[model samples]
Target chain A: MSLYYVQKFIYNINRDTKLQTGFAANADMILANYDLTDEEACALREADIGLLYVMGVNGQLLMHYAAYRGLAWDDYIQAMKDGLAKYGEVRAGSYVTIDGGAGGAV
Target chain B: MSLVFAGLCSHAPGITARAERAPAELREPFFANFNIMRQQLEAAKPDALIVIAAEHFANFFMDNMPAYAMGAAPYYEGPIEDPDWLKIKRRKIPGNANLSFRLIKTIMQDIDLAYSEEWKCDHGIMVPLHFLTPNYDIDIIPVNINCQTAPFTPLKRAWAFGKALRKACDFVDERIAIVATGGISHWPATPNSGKINEAWDRDFLDKFARNDKTALLAYNDEAVYADAGQGGAEIRTFIALAGAVEGRKINIAFYAPIPIYAVGCTIAMVDLDES
Candidate 1:
């Protein structure tokens, strides 16, 4: 729904243990605190970076979220590529795939 | 007369510690270049280093992000977050507050450059310092530009700021080495975050290697931002270095795209003694 809230969730969860606990224990409980679209909430709950990309979450914010999820460097990048292939176009945000419809610039 | 060497580099926190985890083909060339840059710095042996890097809100948040700031403390402590994960030893990086204060006084009083003296560094400054100057023997002057934040300092202005730094260095007694850190396309935290723009990365290195500041300056804010995401704005750090060493020969010491780290990093040597 909003990249701001998506970023806020990741930023806060990374720094705050209470929020991390709440997110791990019950995503719904923590997600309720922010005004996010159902799609954003679901993406955050599932740790679905692909869907999050389509919804336009910024990469800087998304990277920390990926790290928080225990994704290795290669896996994090691969997931982004997969996200573009599966979702088609960066539905929103700064990295909305330039070079027309391609998932990446190449 | 005070300047010795100046260059640009990319700072990927985990690359040094966890490079073996990457594929050999990519990892080999990357480290080879990294070593070359390290050797070059040792050869230059400047008494002090002025690191210009993007602040990832580590020292300041969105609430009070300064466009440009200098850390003038006597002992600058660092690797502000996750030292273990970064493979960087958490320690207090030495600083030259005397030189730092001189530059600050010059820039603020003479050039009227906007600066904050209270800035503390994060990985942006430490990562490159870790690889380039592992000994931490030389004193450092940490400078930060608001690369990640909105309403950032423009590239042209960043270059101009470097010029002011050159003037500031001229007034100081210490022989200084200037290093600008960050960039070569790869979004940091988005879904397509790891996408490496090798084409763009190579083109930038080529221009800089040839000392083509005109071509480098050709890329305005919109062009760079559209091609490379916001974090990529760290290229301004290099632009500032170019301004400091306006007519120097540029050696593209290293160029490697570590997709695992999601950075198309490069290490360069700007020869101040050339002219």
Candidate 2:
């Protein structure tokens, strides 16, 4: 499977423990259900976390401050998915992953 | 074909022509740099200036995204703004529509791409335009590439396009100067804003100065992101410039990191030995 790496602040995971738990749990479930490597798993985790951050109520503020200027929500999501698929699972706790297509991580 | 100049620019604060409004310390240096470039441009005396820059959703967007857009017009108005970069007092420049159209035709025949006859110059083009021709009286031949959206032109492809551009310029039989404007590694926001990658910036500058096309062509989006902060789409401008001036030497004039906007503003000149 193709994988892409998603880089973000480590503080994100620590700051929102509930969201992190849910994303981690979702990532763990996806890994068991699908064929994935350590890298692929890590990438997914990163994507999940990044998505959560983007979907978070404060996501707009973060996006505005981030390098993603004038980016639409759909485009941003697509990029995240592409990153996850291209980089596979994110091995580093600092990264995340996605399926690179519609229907989310499943 | 020899390169006349190559450089990077940060597109924030808009392209203001008023030198006084620029960062106090940077104003003088900026003008000095422009003076040097202007001299080179005058020396070349190109009939038209072929500017390779990225469009910020000016013409293309989510629904329809053209890989590249070439302007074919007698004159192209830059973006509208309150303090317009091209003030009314400045004389409007005409475009070499005949030559621009021919160049686009040639490129399309050689490669599968699209062209546009109607489009306004966005900030990307306006920034350099303002600097190159403050009065906006010169003939402009503009090429807009989509660097924002994905499936972006690879470094290699952008370089190849530059080479093609040289051929296009040659076909027009006009002494031409090319300017590639964009970035040196800056993130224009918060949360992780005010970022500057000095190491990467220097490294990029060094490689660019050496005209290391291969090294540059090898960079993927991820690598660019890794080095040039998250907003590294501007790096593609360098690739395009390298392509246009295939084997020319680069002469760097100014490079200063602006922390306020998290970008490194630089100006460089590339001279091609036509001997």
Candidate 3:
């Protein structure tokens, strides 16, 4: 849904280590700052790499978050592939296509 | 003319963060070319290096993304990704604010260029610097193209920006080297993360080497997405380099489909002294 806020949160965290620390300390408090739906908020709290990819979070931003959550390089790539298989095609944002069909998804 | 060197190269974080995982046969030569480039760049003896990179969301976001932004700071720190994640330590890199101001002012004559005193170096930049300016000795002036978001700067504008940058470098007295860094055809950090289009990458590289402005500017987003993946949109950086060097063909020291690196890894340059 609120893909912009989802991407925005990670973008902010990616740039500001203080914000990253803040999110780690009190995720609920940080969640309140963004106008995010429950699913978006849950995804952030759970460090749900799959759902985040399904929502089309910019891969550049999302990958760092995956690292922050301790997913290794290969695991991170696999998380996205798994997300694609489970959630179907990315619903919005740049990676919306399935495979070469839209390939923004792959 | 102060523009002493110009070239394009790939900057996937995997080059360092996941180094040992890739086949040595491929990785070694790719790294060798980087060493070759660094030696060539040092031989030029530039006081400053202008990095034209396609920044991932390390600085500007969709809220206020500039089509193009340049660094006008005295110094900067980054590898903004975790130092461990990028395999590059976080440290201050030298910059030339005065040189940047002059180049920016000169560029503004023909382009509405945006600038920053506070710029962060993402993997798009850190990866190349790890190879090209390992000591972090030369001052840097980073220019970022908005290759990430939609409604991106048109390919023509990117070329024009390059032309303007060349003029700026020429107008200045300090020896300046420029390396435009970005992936050619890749799906970086995505479900199809390691996907690469060797054919598309080679074709584009051929057009770039020829400095075929018409052919270079002919690519559109849809085809790029289908064949090159979204990261492929970064040809703007290469096109900008082509624009910088004018019509001269670049000598590609290295080129290969390094899929684990998620790009047609390349190290190429044009020596201004010869041109």
Best by TM-score: 3
CAPRI quality level assigned to candidate 3 from its DockQ score: acceptable
Model 2 misplaced regions, further than 4 Å: A1-106, B1-10, B14-23, B81-93, B189-193
Report lDDT (CA) for all predictions.
Answer: 0.72, 0.57, 0.87
DockQ result, candidate 2: 0.03
lDDT of 3 by residue, B121-213 (tens): 989889999989999999999999999989889899999999999999999989889999988988787756677788888898889888999
Clashing residue pair totals per candidate (backbone < 3 A)? 7, 35, 2
lDDT tens digits, residue span B1-275, model 2: 33343444445432243334447786667657866776677677666787777765545544577777787878776453222322423234468778777788767755555667666654567666666676676788777777765777777777777777777666665566777777767543212334667778888878888889877776778777665654576787877777776677677788776544345667887756544
Which lDDT tens digits does candidate 1 get at residues B85-195? 556766878887777888888877634444544545556888788778888998888888878756777777887888899988888877888888987777665434456
State in Å the error of residue B261, model 2: 4.7
Candidate 1: regions farther than 4 A off:
A1-58, A65-71, A74-92, A95-106, B109-120, B229-231
- Candidate 1 vs 3: which has more lDDT: 3
Model 1, C-alpha of A16: deviation from truth (Å): 8.5
Task: Name model 3 segments beyond 4 Å from true.
Answer: A100-106
Clashing pairs in 3: A95-A104, A106-B192
- Candidate 2, residues A11-100, lDDT tens digits: the string is 223223354456556747534544555654563455443433333212212332122223333344455444445544434322222222
Please, what is the TM-score per model? 0.78, 0.67, 0.96
Ranking by TM-score: 3, 1, 2
